[model samples]
Target: MLNHIIGRLSLGGLLARAVSAAALLGAFGGAASAVTVPILVADVDSGRVIYSQAPTDPWFPASITKLMTTYVALDLVRQGRASMDTLITISPNAAAEPPSKMGFKPGTQLTLGNALKIIMVKSANDVAFAIGESLGGSIDNFAAMMNDSARRIGMRDSRWTNANGLPDPQQWTSARDMAILARALIRDFPDDHDLFSISAIQFGGAVIPNHNGLLGRYPGTDGMKTGFICSGGFNVVATATRGGRRIVAIVMGQPSARERDVKTADLFDYGFAQDGGNGPGLDALPGSSSAAPPDMRPYVCGGKKVPAIDEGPGAVSASATTAAQLVGGAAASSPSLALAAFSSPGMRARTLPPRAPLQPVAVWIGRSPAEGQQILAQQAAEAQAAAANVRAARLEAAKARREAVLAKRQAVQAAAKEAAAQKQAAKAAAKASGGVPRSASAYTSSESASMPEAKPGKGLTKAKDAAKPAAHKPVAAKPVAKPVAAKPAPKPAKKAAAKSDE
Candidate 1:
C-alpha cells in the first residue's frame, strides 16, 4: 500500500526518499530537543488536513508579514478603494528603513502594482512601509488592519505588528494559521497568484531572486512564501498542484533549508499516497512524540525588544515630557540661534547702511594717464560704428515700407485720372452726336462713335470708314509738309550759294 501511494506521487514527479519521523528527529539532532517545529499539509481544494505535526504551534513570522500586507493591498484594489496603477510616494520614514529594500529615495514614486511586486520578489521592507503609510497612514494602523483581516479570514493564531516582518516577539503565527492565510490569499487573489511563483524579479539594475525554493525544485509548485529569523529557523508555506489536485503545506522551524525541502517533499508524497487510497503504512509510529517543549524563552522574558514606532508628521515627539516647558524653551532658543547663524554668513555687513565714500588713492606714473586712454577711445569709436550700422538697417526697412505705400497710392491716382479723362472725352463726343452720355460710353472714343444721320445698321460700317481715313490723315499731312519745306529750303540754299560764288 505504501508502494502504491509512492507510485501515485511519482506519477506527477519522481519520488524521493520519504524521511521517517525518526529521521526528522535525527536530522534536527539536538536542536529538536529545544524547538517545536510544526509541519502541516492539507488538500487545498477540500481544506482537509492530510498530515500534521504540531500544526497549531506558534512561531515567529519573520518576513512572512509581507504576504498579509500584499493580501490587504490587493483587497483594496478589489474593493475599488484604490487602483493598481495608483502612485505611492516613499515617505522620509519609509526611506530611512534598512535594506532588503527597493531603495527608492524619499520622494520617489511607484505604482501600487510595482510596489507589491517589489514586496513579493525583493521582500523590500521600505516598499512595505511606504505602502502601509500610503494606504493606512501609518504602519501601526496598517498592522491593525492586518490583524482585522486575519480575524476575517479565520487566521485565529496570527497577529501582525508590522508590514514587513522584521522581528517582534509580539508578532507570531502558527503553521495552521499561516496555511489558512495562504489559502485565503490564493482564493481571493487568483489573478495575482502568479507573482508568488516567479523565481526572480528584476527592478532597475538590482535582481532579487525569490527565497522560496519550491518554485524551482518542485514540479507542480506554483506559489506561497518563505520566511526566516534566528529564532524561527526557516519556514515556508508551499502550494502545489498535480492532475488538478492542489495542496498547501506549511513547514516551520526546519533546521536548514535542505531539511525544509526534504520534509516538504515527504509531506507531498504522503499526501499523494493517501489520496490514492494507499493503506496507512506508518501506524507503528507514535501519534504524538514526547519531544521537549518549544523554547519561548526568547520571547517570554524581558529580553524581547519592542520596535520603535514611527511618529508621523504633526505627531508630538515621544521624548517631549513637559509640554509647556518644551514649547517655551524651543521658542526662546530658536530665534537667537537663527539670527546668529543668519548674521554669520557675511549678511550682517551686507545689510548695514552704506558708509561715507572713501577717497581715491592716487598713483604717480612716468607718463600721464591720458596716454593709456587712446585704446579706450578706439573701442568707443568701434562701438559707435556698430550702433550706427544697426540704426541704418532699421532706417532702411522703414524707408522700404514708406516707399511701397507711396507707390500703391500713385497707382490708384493714375487709374482715377485715366478714367476721368476718358469720361470727359466720351461726354464731349455724345454732345457732338446729340445722344445722352451712358456710363458704358465713358470707355468709348470718337473712333467707336457713329454719325446720327447714318442708318442704324450701317452706322458701324460708316464709323469704320471714317476711322480708316482719320488713321491715314496723319501720314498724308506728313508728306504735304515735307514738299512745302523742300521748296523753301532750295531757295535759301541757292541765295547762299550765289553770294558765296561772287
Candidate 2:
C-alpha cells in the first residue's frame, strides 16, 4: 500500500502540486474550515463551472452511486439491451445489502421502472443491487460496466466496487465525476426526466419520500439526489433552474444533512447570481490523489457525532424537483412552491411540493412481450397452486373435527346402554326380594310369555346358563310350600290299607 501511494506520488507529483496550487487559488472565496466538503456549482447549459472547491478530491459516493447505476440501465434501454419494464428479480446478493434498503426478500419481482423509482425515492440499496444484476447479470460484471462507462465519459476520479455504495475503500467518486454523471443522465435520457422529479413514491400504503431536499423547498429545485455514509459524510448532487439559466451543484462530506442542504442551496443562490461564465471546464477540474480520502468516522461518528439524517421534507435538503427540472434542461420551468418558500423571509420549509403522480408499469422476467406473459402465467399458476394447498389444509382440518364429533357421540351412546343395564339389575334385585310363587304353575305359559322377565335373571340367563345349567339350577332352587287337596290324604290312607293286605 505504501509502495502504491509512493509510486503514484512519484509519477503524479506534478499533477498533485498543480492541484494544490489551484485549490489554494480557489480557497480565497470560501473558508477551508467552513466547507470541509468538495463542492461545485456549474451552469448546466453553458458548460460553465461557477464554483469549485476540491471538486476533484476522492470521496465515497454512498447512495448517490445509484445515479450511475440508473445511467447504465438507461443506456441499455436505449440500445434495446433492456427495457424499463424489464423484470429484476431480487437475488440473494441483492437482498443481502444493508439497510437504507427496501428490504425486498429474495426472488421478489419488480419492473426496472419500479426498481428505479425505489432507488430514487427510497434510496433503496437492495433494489439498486437487483437493478445491477438484471442489467449486467451480476454486481461485479455491472461494476465493470460502470467503470467502462465512466472512463468513456472522462470521470477520472470515480470508480465503483458495489452498486449500493455501502462502505468499500476501493469504491469512491469525486464531486466532478458525480457532476458529470448527473449531467449525462439528464442529457441522454429525456423521457426518464420525470423519474428524477418524482417527489415521493407510495409503497405498501406508506409514502417513501425522496432524499433530495431542494425539490419542494427551493422554487427552482426540480431533480437530483442526496447521499451519505459514515465515511462519506452527507453528499448531494443537486440542480436548479431560474429563468432560462440552469445549474448543477455537488456538495460532499458535510457534518450534517441540514448543513449540507442549506450550504448547497446557498451556493446555487450564489452561482445563479454570477454575471458571466468564468471557470475551468468540467473535464479540466483540478484533482489530487486517486487514492481514497481519509476516513470520516472520527469526524462523523466519533468525537462530534453526526446526527441521524432522514432526507425529505423537514430534513436538511434543497429542492430536488428543481434539480430534476435542471435534468430536464427545460427552459420553461417555473418557480415552484419551493421557490416561493425560498423567496419568503425566514421560512424554513417543512415538506416538499406535491408530485404529479403516475403508477409505474409492471416489469417481469422475459425476453419479449410473449415471454413476459408466459412468466406472468406461471406466477399465476403457482399462486393458484398455493391457494389450493391452503384450501386442502382447511378441508383436512374440518374433516378431523367432524370425525372427533362422531367419536364423541358413539361413546355417549355406549355409555347410555351400560347405564340402562345397571338400572335394570337394581330393579330385578328389588322384585326378587318381594313375594312371588316359586312354582312353575304360577307363571302360566301365556303369563310367562308376556312376563318373561318376572324372575330375576331368568330370561337372559337361559342363554347364559345353557353353558352351565346344572350349576345355576342348584344354586337358586329354594322349594316353596303349597296347599294340598283333601282327596290326596284319603287316597294315601286307601293305598296304606292295600299295602297291609299285600
Candidate 3:
C-alpha cells in the first residue's frame, strides 16, 4: 500500500495529492451540512420570482400534494366529466388511510363539493383517497391524471404517486414546481378560488380548522395549503393578497410549524416590498442537481416525537418575543407579520396572535340537504335493526342452553329409575327363597317354557345340592377322565337316523 501511494505521489505532485484529499473531505463535509430549506416567492400575475433559496432543488411534497388533487378534480369539472354534486363513496381502500383522516366507514357517501371542503381545510387523507377512487376510478388512474395535468401546466419537476400527499420515496416536488401549480390553480379555476381560501369546515358538530397557520392569523393570507412528515419537515404553498397585489410563497423543510409560518410571513413581506421582478420567471429557474429529493428525517424529526398530521392552531411559543425583535419589531405595528428577515440566527420562530372565531362552511353527505336528512334517517333505522337482530340472536342462544340442560337432567333421572327397578326385582326374588337361591349362571335358558316344570321336591333337592360344598374326591377325577376317553364316536348315519325317528 505504501509503495502504491508513493508511486501515485511521484506521478502527481505531493501538492496535487494533498489538494485532492482536501477536496474529497470538503465534499463529505458539505453533504453533512446539506440540510437545505428551499423557499420561493413569486408574483401571481407576472409569473416572476421575487425571492428564492434553492427553489429548484427537489423536496418531498407531503400533504401539499393535495393541491394537485384539488386541481385534477376541478379540471374534471371543467371538462364536463364531473360536477360538484358528484357522489364520492368511501371504499375499503380509502377508509384505511392513516390519520388526518375522517375515519369514515366503508360505504359512506358524500358529495364532491363536501369532499373538497374537507380535504382543503382538514387535509383528510381518507377523503382525498376516496375522491381519487371515485373520480379517477382508482388511485393509480388518478395519479396518472395528476401527472398529466402537472406536465401540461409546466410543473416540470413534480411527480405524484398518490392523491393525498402521504410519504412515498418516488414522490417529490420543488418550490418552483409547487409555485407553478399554485399559479395554475389560481388561473384555470378562478370561479372556484374560494375553495383554497377556506378557514375551517364544519362536517357535523366538530369544526376542523385548516393546517395552514397563516390563513386567519396572517392578514390578507387567504388560500393555499401546508404539509408535514418526518422526511419532509413542514411545507407550505401559501398565497397572500396585500394592497390589491397577490403573490404565492413556497416554504419547505422547516423544523417546526412555527418556523414554517414565520418564514412564509417574512417571504410575503419581502415579496410585497419588491417593486420589480427579482432574477427570472418561475419557469426560467435552472434545473436541480439531482432528481431525487433529500430526506429530512434527521433534521426535522431527530430526537423528537413527530406528529402524524399537519400542525393545528397552537399558542405562540415563548420565543415569540425574541423573534419579534429579530424581525425589527414589526409584530407590534401589524398583526400580519414580523418583517423581512431570512437568517437562521434564532431559527426565525414567530408568535401568531389568536385567530378569530371561524365561520366554518357547512359540509354534509348526500346530494342535497333534504336528501342528506333522508340518508341520516335511513342509517339510523338500519342501526336499530342491526341492534335488534343481535339481541334476538343472544336470546335464542340462551334458550338453547336451557333446553339442553333440561334434556340432560331427564336422561340421568331415567337411568336412575331403571337401576332401581332392577334392584327391586332382585330383592323380591331373593326374599321368596328361604335358603340361598341357585345361582342364575348354573342354569341358563333362552326360553323358560322350553324346560318342563320341575317337581316341588326335586326343585328343593336341587337347590340344596347346589348350595352344599363339594366333597374332595381323591381317585374319582382320574376314573371319570379315563371313561370319557374310552367312549366311541357317534356315526353320522346313526345320528341322522335318530333325528328322523325323533
The C-alpha local distance difference test score for the whole of candidate 1 amounts to 0.59
Better of 2 and 3 by lDDT: 3
Which 10-residue window of candidate 1 scores lowest in summed lDDT?
311-320
Model 1 residue runs over 4 Å out of place are: 1-34, 276-502
Off by over 4 Å in 2: 1-35, 303-502
Rank by TM-score, highest first: 3, 2, 1
Stretch of 10 with least lDDT, candidate 2:
3-12
Cα RMSD to the true fold for all candidates = 32.1, 16.0, 13.8
Encode model 3's per-residue lDDT on 1-502: one tens digit a residue. Answer: 3222222211112123333211211111343533345778789988988766678878999889999999999999999999999999999989999979988879989999999989988899999999999999999999999999999999988889999988899999899999999999999999998998888887656788778888777778878998988888788999999888999999887666776776677667666767535458987888877768877776567777768666544334333333345556654443223322333345333366566567799888888777877877787799899999999999999999999999999999999999999999999988887554445434422124333334433543443444454765443454333322222323542343233322
Residue 260, model 2: lDDT of: 64
TM-score of 2: 0.59
Clash count for each candidate, listed in order shown: 0, 26, 0
TM-score of 3: 0.67
The Cα error of candidate 2 at residue 19, in Å, is: 18
For candidate 2, give the lDDT of residue 126: 87
How well does candidate 2 match the true structure, expressed as C-alpha RMSD? 16.0
Error at 437, model 2, angstroms = 68
- Using TM-score as the measure, which candidate wins? 3
Per-residue lDDT tens digits for candidate 1, residues 1-502, read 3222222211111112333321222122344443335767677766777656566656777677788998999999999998887777789999988756766667766678777776766677888899998998898999999999999988766778888877677888777777778888889988989777766665433355666655555557787777655566556788888888888888766433444554464455456545522222122212333222343334222254422221001111112122123223331323222112211213111211121222222211112234324534554688899899999999999999999999999999999999999999999988897564354232223222232233424444544554453555555344333322212223443344333322
